[model samples]
Target: MTDLQIRATAAPAAPGTTARPGLLLLLVLTGQFMALLDVSIVNVAVPTIRTDLHASGAALQLVIAGYTIAYAVLLISGARLGARFGYSRLFQYGLVGFTAASLACGLAPNTGSLIGFRLLQGVGAALMVPQVMSLIQRTYTGAARARALGLYSAVIAGGMAIGQVLGGLLVSADLFGAGWRPVFLVNVPIGLALLAFSRRLLPVLPGDSSRRFDLVGLVVLAVALGLLVVPLVLGHELGWPVWAWVALAGSAAMFGLFGVVERRIAARGGQPLIPGRVLRAPGLVPAAGAIFLIMAGFAGFMFAFALHQQAGLGHSALRAGLLSGPVAVGFGLSSLHWQRLPQRLHLPLPMLALAVVAPAYLVFGVILRGGAEIGFGAEAVLTTAGLAAGCAYSPLFARALSRVDPADAADGSGVVVTVIQVGQVVGVALLGTVFLGEVSFPAPARTSGHALLVTSAAIALAFAAAAAFALRTRRAAG
Candidate 1:
């Protein structure tokens, strides 16, 4: 470890010592902002990337999906890895790697190389993110911890909103004649600044060296996820070849294998990545289904919306990005209102939010069919939907945790995180196919209309799953 890492890992300067929680929160939120920004930022630049790199349909999807794939697959393992390596060391390493990856992505000569570097970027994010909550848990207690967590959630939603605007602005400016490259190049300086000041700005706690990891489980899960994601993203474009069918079959088999391996590991008193028993828990499957449906709609909307503005409506990148500002405003303001709500409503809000948001999506689709132009009318609907979107996620997460068996809480949360990622991956892949193949981009309004309708149907399914989970939970309580 470097001197800074050593300093971060060492005991505090004084007993009962507390570093400045305010600064510490800033440090954690910054890391989170960078991670979240990258996910949505690329959406606005997707068209530019395709044209500049002469990317194929599959490569374009890969450019987007690869990062999420790596991040989702490795998140739980990253947490366990931090336990062995120490959060401070892992965090520092992740920051450096992420910075380097950003530079690589900005400088990438082709789509293949960009895809490869994006995956590396995701690896760094996986390492950096799991430590945020761990650090907050280490530094703050009780009400302070709760506030910090709320701030963290707000950062996620806000970052996503900002990412769209930023990407649009960056690409529109064509900075240094670099076009969309700055969308990624922008991360380099921020990553470096974080590296320089992280030791000073962040607080760290001791490591638990006794934690054991399941490498076999990690490998099995990775293969399983790849099997599911790859074919879905590439299948229709390739005419649904025999290989796609093989991959889908392989995905099913790999999932079964993952369960068997995890079960055997737990049977032998080993630390399995996922606990087999949690799979059988009451209401857990429905909860996962609900969360997956919610995220799928969320991810699909981002991918399709950006493309519709740029390719269909002929909006300049900056205008598209600027249009997204209201989404952030709506989400940020609504999130504050959400936080003030009674704690009892937290678990049910996701279902309720999705129920309303579904119609809002349909409403937007109806308006777009008239004209997909980014006018006062469309922007207004986006802001309203943003308010509903803000309510959807936190509550679903709360519900998932509340439904889990106490003994399986840790693994249950871990599974929820993975499922959320998987849902996003599927969303981008499945709906991306629709956006590329079905929608008539030349007809701007029709294109936008079709895409939003797709998202509406997806959200409706999520609402259904949420309704099922709600009924199941009420019956159990009764």
Candidate 2:
């Protein structure tokens, strides 16, 4: 056997007695929800953050996206850490640290400090979030595992919605005159409550000694992402200077090197960050790539759309945040409804979702293309997009892991999530950068409109990728 073979033994629920698996699922979902909330919670508060901190456009994007960058970079390593230590052990620790980081973010005196704290929050999130799936896989079998994953998807979708609403309401309420800080401070009580029960509720699996941590692979991958993102985020502000060009080139080279290093590690019979096999797995590569493109499109559109509402339409932060709430509503409805669906049918959900979303985007494009004023019709369009995303996500997770062995759940979950974060960074960086280039003060509707067209193209690509993956997987099953 090649040294690169990924192997692990998972201990499911206690043999005779059904462990209070419900509580375990609750704990996992709670942690996952909190982490996912941070991703969108700040969207509502972005303008407030910018005004209060005197942040530049680049600084604003960093404040919002820094968490994702850190989370993506460290996730694979964090998964290995969970394997080495224990999933429950890491969950508790990560929860506590995450809570503290939230406090720091609320109290941050400057933009730099806030961004730094947000990155730390990402680290804390990365540590805790992967375990939710790992524990679910470890504690449940068959039907229950499917339910847990569904609930996880529901929480994630619901959290994004709730975050936007709460962020707007909190900032508008101006509680204790805290303003944008409450969006972050709200995590403290929730994290502590989750932490208190984690020890008793979560299963404590023995560390998998067989999995090796490849630090060199981690470093190169980090560098690769940094190079790719830094230039993309900063290129517009810096007028696409020589340094940005250098960074872009270096990022491409670093990514290539990262793959080489990882392949070498696997060839040497050692574990690398991402299993060499996972990349080569049938239907997996295209699915992962599609996810990246779709998220980039989705996230970019959301960011740009938010900016348009606030800056161009003269909407208040609360009002602007509420605009995307429909998407969340659609997502929640679809995911919760799908929980009862048959397993065999789940794989084709994404392909089906694209059919729904394609027309919606075209309509949204036409609306934005109009020379006259657009009304609340845009909300309807966004809600449709949200519904499509919700439809896609739940099934997407299940389908991607369809070919993966249950024993390798930890690594599989980590790899899937890692790609998600990377996709997010790409979305925010490019969209935010592009949005800034065209959006001038006092009326950015035209520029924002143009950006939505770009998003349409990205989403179209996502649809194609999904179609390819669906075809490949369907044939494989047959």
Best by lDDT: 2
Residues 180-208, model 1: lDDT tens digits = 89988999999998888787866555666
Regions of candidate 1 where Cα sits further than 4 Å from its true position: 1-18, 276-287, 342-347, 402-413, 440-448, 451-455, 470-478
Question: Cα deviation of 159 in candidate 1 (Å)?
Answer: 2.8
Per-candidate local distance difference test: 0.73, 0.74
Q: Against the true structure, what is each candidate's TM-score?
A: 0.89, 0.91
Report the alpha-carbon TM-score of model 2 versus the true structure.
0.91
Model 1 residue 441 CA deviation (Å) reads 4.8
Q: Give the top-scoring candidate (TM-score).
A: 2
lDDT of 2: 0.74
